[model samples]
Target: MANRTSRDVLLRGLWVLGQGIREQPGLFTVGVGGSVVFGLLTIASAYVVGAIVGEVVVPSIESGRVETGLLGAGAAALLAVSVVKVVGIFGRRLGAGFMQYRLQASYRRRVTRRYLDLPMSWHQRHPTGTLLSNANSDVEATWFPVAPLPFAVGTVVMLVTAIAALFATDWVLALVGLAVFPALFALNVVYSRRMAPRQVRAQQLRAEVSGIAHESFDGALVVKTMGREAQETARFAGRAVELRDALISVGRLRGLFDPLLETLPSLGTLAVLLVGAARLRQGAVSVADLVSVAFLFTVLAFPVRAIGWVLAELPRSVAGWDRVRHVLTATGEMPYGDTELPAAATPASLVFDRVWFSYRPPVGEPAAPATADQSVDPTAVGVPGANTALPPVLRDVSFTVPAGRTVALVGPTGAGKSTIAALAARLVDPTAGRVVLDDVELPRLTAGSLARTVSLVAQVPFAFDDTVRANVTLDRPGLTDEVAWSALRLAEADGFVAALDDGLDTVVGERGTTLSGGQRQRLTLARALAGQPRLLVLDDATSAVDPRVEAAILAALRNSEIATSILIVAYRRATIALADEVVYLDQGRVVDHGTHQELLARCPGYNDLVTAYEQAEAERERTRSGTGTGDSGGGDPGGGPARAAEVVA
Candidate 1:
């Protein structure tokens, strides 16, 4: 069973090499051609040396006279052979390097493109660090064997020809050649069997270590603020130590086999000398034949190890290929349609028709039916777990934001507000029913059309490390400084931007670390606005800004010349009042829908939640103002239904 498994691994490794060769056949051909040239010349050089020793050196000693011309000719011949051999080596190394690097680069691109193609749910299931490893180290390992592949191929040819030459010279020497080569191959097989598990373990550890490191670094603020630096360091150190040990195991095995592989050829040389001297005495072999065979064995030592090098790397190559292949062949990519929406400067209306959505459990969890009577279509919108019993985040939820109006989604925590926002922008498709834009189902619209018609500003804003102009415009064609400035002004971010040293040209640090939280949020909002989206979804996007600034920004958006519908996951009473209508949600179900004052008057749940929020804001303001008014009633400075009514009026 063990041998069968090892043989299977070997064949798989060879298949991987074949894939690389097929992808870049021209480079592989050039590499192998060079290796063959080098191999043939190497064997010839052995004979050349033997001939000089037997023909020129032996005769000269016997006559006690040196033939300078003959000696010079031999020198010239050796020099020519050495020079040609150098050219062969150059070609072989150059081709192998180019082929390996090209394969790595190509697969990296394919893996990254696949990441982009897969759905957000798919990405959520995977760790970012693991993805980074798959694209970098794993990709590198998959092609690492390519570097030694051509040399191994040429070495095989060299071994075969050398054995044949040995038989032609003398069968006794050929017998020695036959024994040593097989033993070398058998030792390599043993080494590979032992190395396979260790190499695979090492590769897994590398990914784990990367995952822990990325998580720690990405949450640097949380780590430092929570004072868990020691725990985080220990967590990272644990994984790093395991990776170190795994690599050490790999190195130890390689160390053990390397000398044994090198010793085999030297042993063969010693045996050849012992047998050939006896043959020379019996007139079975000449001095040149004995010398040539010994020289060939001496030179064959390093080249023979090329085969070992490839075999040893097969395990690592197979492991990396499996990981990389998993990413390249991952399913659940959100497929798009060819339907295009007609271009219109007017706002786009959004509607949810009994939309139901549920987050899929990761791969191994039990999958029960989502609903007893609701049948799921496997081909519907590429949403996994539609048949699973995972409680739907949104259940039979129906709402609409009419064109040229604003709708606020008022919900407590875990009320599916963000999910609704995601559906509004078509970042994800509904598990059941339809999310329509401009009277067309979102899934039926082309990605380009959907992107042009809608924009989503998430709660956690992300800014690229780039110039302010680049961040806002994102290199979108025809968006100039004028457009960016207009968007920035709408988001209330223009003043600070204008004060920057280089204005729009100034580089923001990674994730906009150079800017304050409010500044980053405003900048991201401006980015969304600059796209000129007809339908915009803000998933509590302005939470970082002051409530006054947030209200102003909403007012600016509503009164802007550009006609666009707005969907806001709003928490502040002021912001909700600015909406034309409000949808109150509780536990993923729409509790009620009406104007802010109407909900406050009729819905007890909405009234209580709003009252609590109002009292909290009033207390915070009192604290900020250093006043001990302690007014927590309805008539406090933080307004309830009456204040919301005033804002609306």
Candidate 2:
């Protein structure tokens, strides 16, 4: 039952991978042809060895004749077979290597495309390392079957050739060799069945370890600064040890199967030699026949070993193929609709209609037994038992931003401010209501059109490890040096950027580690500006820059008359003080909407929040003045300098 289930899954996986190969006929041809050539050469060598033993070695010994021609012919045939063998092996490697490169490259690109298609909500739950590993390591691991499979099947052909030769010599010995096959095949099937699940577990553990390591590496400074080095190390070491143990478990099974596969073939050879020797002594088999059978068994044994190796690796490769297919087969977050949003002659307005959303929480595990002795522990959580459900993240929410206007979102940490910003950008779609841009539904806009229409500047701006110009321009093209610098200047970042030794050409370390947080934040704003978006959504974009620099950037935006709608998500009153309108959210529900002055008089929650923000700023300044440190660990780097400057607005 187990063997059948594993084989079923294995075949299904191969069928999917084969579809990829079939779509690219040229690559498949090269791979298949190489294997065929190698198999033919292998069989030819075996035939030559058997012929030489029967026609030369035994006859010459019996007649006391020196058959020089036979010896010469055998030597020449061996030389020819050796040359073919080397050529076949070289071609197979070359072809398989090319196929692997092409497949991995193509699949990686497809995975990236799918990632872009998925919504921001999906990205939150999925770790960076897990996705990265799938696109790289998982895809690469799948290539193992591609190289070994065709050759292994070709060996099957060689097995048939050996059986035909044996039958021609003697039917009884041929039947004996055939009988050994079922036993050998049964053992391989059983071994593969049991090991497949183990291999799958090992691969999963490897992915988890990779995710943990990547997370740790990315947050190395945080872990060290918080004095959690030992804790982080222990966490990472636990995952690593689990992965190691899983691999070791699978390795032991592989060790046993490989030797058993090789040794079992020897037993078949032993049976042939014993039975053939007895037949010859009874005069039932000729001397030449006995010699040929022995030679055939010797040649055939190696193919059995090759077949066994392939069988052992088959499960792992199939499991990898399934993982790759999971990503390939997934339905990504691309917008679906029949209508398209038309290009605007001028920037248009945004409106949200009774918007409601909630995170699709992770599937929970079943409750465990209270004690360790119980089969179902009360404390342990296994896969869910179908009674529990996930909770909501957002409730009814609605707001609007007119063309060329600025709107602000203020709320507590978990009040769904970021989620709203993401929805506005169509980074995610609302569950119960529609977001319309210039009257067209958000989901109807094509990716290109949507990006041109809206741009997001988040609190934690992403920075690629590349030149400043490259990171700023990102995937967009056609921006000249002057245009890039102009955008940077407008973001209040040009001065610091120009101070760098390489200027805009300087390579930023991983995630812009070389730059200060404020600088990185400004660079992201510059990127958004470079897009010349119709709607610029800043989700705490100025959180790192000094309040002084942030005011300058905002002043530039207010004065430019660029006619782009802006949505700013922030807690600071000064950040949104100049906004034409404000939307105050409390516990995922919008409780107030109006001008800042209007809300201060009518909305107590809004008034209280502003008061708290002002009071906190005063307290922080007092502390800084008293201590002479001028640091609170959270203020915008440019905030202090900006606060001291006059704001024309």
Candidate 3:
């Protein structure tokens, strides 16, 4: 895993660096040119110093003839060297800034694109916090390798030049200086090997901490209502502490190796000083040669040590790159649909043929998860520290909903009602069998066509931290204010929206925190309806709103001239009553399909579900009206939790 991870990360970082250079070659040229110029300047400065010591300093002292011309030449050389150094420094900063911006923009987009393309099922298995961390810290970590490459290359090149210069002056001193390079490189490699896995662990911990914190923030109401604030806080704190400790371990390793890397060059310098002095006493080396060699050694050691540090950092940067690559190079969920879909707004029929699916969650290792029900005991199938078995959430399930019609899904919690709706929208795909839209398999449909054809309003629609108009239109260009208002009216959201202080321009706050549950649900429905898709899939979207508002929304949906297929996944009787047919799912298979009256007559489970929903809603209403002795919130509902989904049409 470590070797593969390193290779993957290394290749990706270099590729990203190459892309940066490819995009803005001028900036790349500046960065590269500056480093090369700096290296040459150092060599020139060293040679000049040697010349001064030999022709000017020594002769003047020995013959008592101080030449002003020689002193002036030395000053001119020093001034020239300083000017080159200044230019190089300025060019490097400008080039690095441009490179950093260009690379970061591309990398961020790549990460986002990967996330967008991944199957919804893939998303379900991973935590939001980990994804957040991948986008932030992981991307930044990968930046190190790209940003340092120019410097690293320049350092290595300069070190080589210095070594060659030493050899030309005296092979003995050159060999001594060269000997330290191998030991320093070996030390770097060892430290890097040890740091890679630890860094990976640390990255994961950081993600976990972010995920926990995000969850807490998103579910603040639930935590407070349940009086579990302390518990959740402690859980988050534990994760944070884990990440901190892991980072400290990384810091400790860096601390140890950095000092050693710095000290190695000093020790080499000391050896050179001692040996050169002894040689000078024996008249084996000239004073000028010793001074030039020492000057060259100082210049070379700095770059050599810097190169060593960069090498040590490569593994960690690569570890981050591996994480990013995991997302970028992952097999996309389902597949793209390239087949042409009709441009007409008419509803498209959906068909399922021998469909089979299984959920693969992210587990303890880097392997794809196993089937959900096979009981590959994590402990038994573990590869020492690796475990990759996912708890399967779905299996072979098959059913169909004709075009220009409505189908209701009835099932126990986790029985795949929402999963089926998601599949219809191509949010996910079956492991086996095909889900076809208008006879064209979903995987063959182009993404734009599929999106236009299958619209879904999921339970709990995500509201952004933007104005109501932006939220309703969802930033889809060409969706005018007039059109947005029409959607709000259709979703029964206009009334509440108009009452707000800023009306359509009011900020919704993060996740629509400022709005009531019913208002947020209506806004989500309005956004889904804005596109006017051909097939509308709503997974219990009305669960949060009051019965009156839900009834009004249902009436509007039934009355709308959308001419589209609608699949409503709900436990509420009112929603089922409006459906033309009900498909009852039990376990992982479809048990029955028919109209409400027909299902009530033929399927016992269908009747039970309706009876349960009626009782639950009645209880809620009685509690709200203060006519019931039970708790106001119901604590839990009889028909199970109602997750508000989207209205795709």
Q: Residue 194 in model 3: shift from native, Å? A: 4.0
Which portions of model 1 miss their true places by more than 4 Å? 61-64, 363-384, 614-649
Over the stretch 399-507, how does candidate 1's per-residue lDDT look in tens digits? 9999999999998889999999988877677888789888998888899999988999998778899999999999999999999999999999898799888999989
lDDT of residue 615 for candidate 2: 81
Write candidate 3's Cα lDDT for 473-579 as tens digits.
87887789998888899888887788788999999888886765667777898898888878889988777766667778878876887667888887878778888
lDDT of 2 at 489: 85
Query: What's the ranking of the predictions by lDDT, best on top?
Result: 1, 3, 2
Task: Output the number of the TM-score-best candidate.
Answer: 1
What's the lDDT for candidate 2?
0.74
Q: What is the C-alpha lDDT of each candidate?
A: 0.86, 0.74, 0.74
**Model 3 alpha-carbon drift over 4 Å, by segment:** 1-29, 49-72, 93-97, 170-172, 180-183, 214-225, 283-286, 336-341, 345-356, 363-404, 431-441, 475-478, 593-604, 626-649
Query: Model 2 reaches what TM-score against the true structure?
Result: 0.86
- Compute the lDDT of residue 135 as modeled in candidate 2: 89
Error of 2 at 606 (Å): 2.7
In model 3, the number of clashes is: 16
Model 2 over residues 1-649: C-alpha lDDT tens digits? 7767798856754675576567566766665576667767776776677678778887888899969998999999989988977777776667666776787788889888888777676676577888887888788767656666556666777677767877887888888879877677788777777787887887777778888889899776566556778998899999899889988988898888778777776787788889988888888777667766666666566655655665666666676777777777765455566565555636668998877665544323332322332122222123232112223345567889898889999877788899888988987776666799988898777777887778899867678999989878875778878778888988888887898889989997788777766778888898998877888899988775556667788989877645588899976778768899999998778998999999999999889988897787667557556756432222233324322221100
Of the two candidates 2 and 3, the one with more favorable lDDT, higher being better, is 3
RMSD of 3: 6.3
